[model samples]
Target: MSLIARTGPQEYECRVGVLDSLTEKLRVRGITKVLIIHGTDSWDKAKNYLTQLMDSDITLEFALFNGECTHEEVDRIVGLISQTQAEAVIGVGGGKLMDAVKFAADKSSGVESVLIPTLASNCAPWTPLSVMYTAEGVCLGFVIHTKQVNLLVIEPNLLLDAPVDYFVAGIADTLAKWYESDVVLSRPEYQTNALLLLSRAAALNCRDSIVNYGLQAVKDIQNQTLTPAFIQVSETIIAVSGLVGGLGDGYSRSTVAHAVHDKLTAFPETHTFLHGEKVGYGIMVQLAIEENWAEIDRLAVFYESLNLPKTLADLNLSDLTEEQLGEVAAKVAVDPILLQSQYRVSKEVIQGGMRSLENYLATTV
Candidate 1:
């Protein structure tokens, strides 16, 4: 048995106005020169929170994140760090920007990294891995960094004005923790492992907390209200969901649900969909593969309420030709995460699961 769990950042703080301490944190660490990489719009949202840091004596270099966390983007940020001789890099945006900064910092020898997420889109701020994609937005898997984030500061006030769709997508992505981890953790062999048990508990907490608070949190963001439910759901998404993979290691990291996501990303028509929206549909596909129609029915109601994708039509892939659909199935059939789960499935099995899920939905509608 092998276990590799990179729990989270060395230091994490989530509260309103917590960013006031950032400059001092850096000063004490002796990080005099820093690189600030941010998204265009995200910078506008987050800049006001960093007034103190901007006024500090520490030297700063700024770079606009190029959107995708591609290898080229990592190389560019790495080059910027080298040229500027930045002692640390700070990412202020959504997941892509944070992932790119972490990857670049890892490649930059002794450079430290800090994250201040402007969007509650995913666990990118808490996790020590970066999900890489092509320039055109195709998924190219992810890389786990050896060095953890030096700090993660979540200014809930900054996220209050974030787009509602991204917040909803975050809920969908975080919910995948339970559905994905249970697929492997429920096995008899994993039942006795202490760490996996903790991972399982954390994953279950993600599901329960999201179910209990998700809708209210949605209303919270829609009205720009900072309520208790909103804070609860936000922490659940970024912190607790992170522990599913953090404690369970590779065993609960991902499975068929994420595999289905990788396959769907190959289609350009699906490019407009968010990561969690795609994974929401992948959950149904995974359930269909296991012939768990009941669970799919239950989740379909929740997914509909959240406006998450539930069908090929929802993903704009209903017009795909049989050959194209077959290609997706074939790719999913051999997905690394799927294979790693020890569940053998053929391309035909995947295609049938898709068809079955559609047929079931047709009956429900």
Candidate 2:
């Protein structure tokens, strides 16, 4: 596990008309040339946005991520910046691509970064942290440096068109921090009000957004009605969900919510789902283990209603058979690690949690 790095808000904005703020932020930084990093899945949309920007005096170059990023992709983005000497690097897309850009910026020299998230799946755009992937595209671990993004642009008008699953997954991922951060806050060893404040701020910001507009965001996506829902999601997924939640909880210690995400990823068949979808279910399982079934279950049903995974098989996970509980427990039993959780966590504790999860899935809708 990587050490936690507490980051300041630097700056946060969630008002209407945020996309328009991007141009001025760049100009103030004296950035004349920009290198854009985006994903191939959203290549056309990325191009459209880039074209709009090109109409301005700013020189622009774009690199579409072919698929999952590799060291080569990071190197390529860095190499492009070195060769082009672009004043800044801007990343557009989901969390993974953002992580790629942020890491490359850290490894590079002098070039600052701006983030424009096309989706709100994870708070990657808001945090200074980055997750590095191996050549094969597995998340090797995280890259924790003090580097922070200068500008983050979230246009709900843009994200409202992406699949509803992305919005749902974003909530799922954001919601995990509500539980995980609290778990960290409980630990006697890792006590810091400053840290907890950041974590709780992220949690509450997301919780409030979810309570108010989370359903609206989902309903808007389902109905394809983008007006109010787009506006809400722009803040919920992009601003509140991405930046505030990211700065608050992301830079803090993540307990079971993320650990479960990691362990579940070991089963490659589960790759079809988004990270937040898997993580949402992980939060459910964590809630069950902690014996706080009622609170977590209420949200799990929301996820179920949204068509997120509620069962082990739903995650495409079959390797974690009933017989494998002991091994899973032992593997997860890292001392001071599990202790940081909101509740006491042990091998027996996790086994009980898994058992409860199995039971919960057996009965719930």
Q: Give the top-scoring candidate (lDDT).
A: 1
Q: Roughly what TM-score does model 1 have, to 2 decimal places? A: 0.98
Quality of model 1 by C-alpha lDDT: 0.90
List per-prediction Cα lDDT, in the order shown: 0.90, 0.68
- lDDT accuracy of residue 364 in candidate 1: 93
- What is the C-alpha lDDT profile of model 1 across 95-211, one tens digit per residue? 999999999999999999999998887889989999999999999888999999999999998887899999999998898888888978989998999999999999999999989
Candidate 2: Cα lDDT at 327: 67
Lowest summed lDDT window (length 10), candidate 1:
335-344
- Per-model clash counts, in order, read 0, 1
TM-score of predicted structure 2: 0.86
| Weakest lDDT window of 10 consecutive positions for candidate 2 | 1-10
The residue pairs found clashing in candidate 2 are 183-342
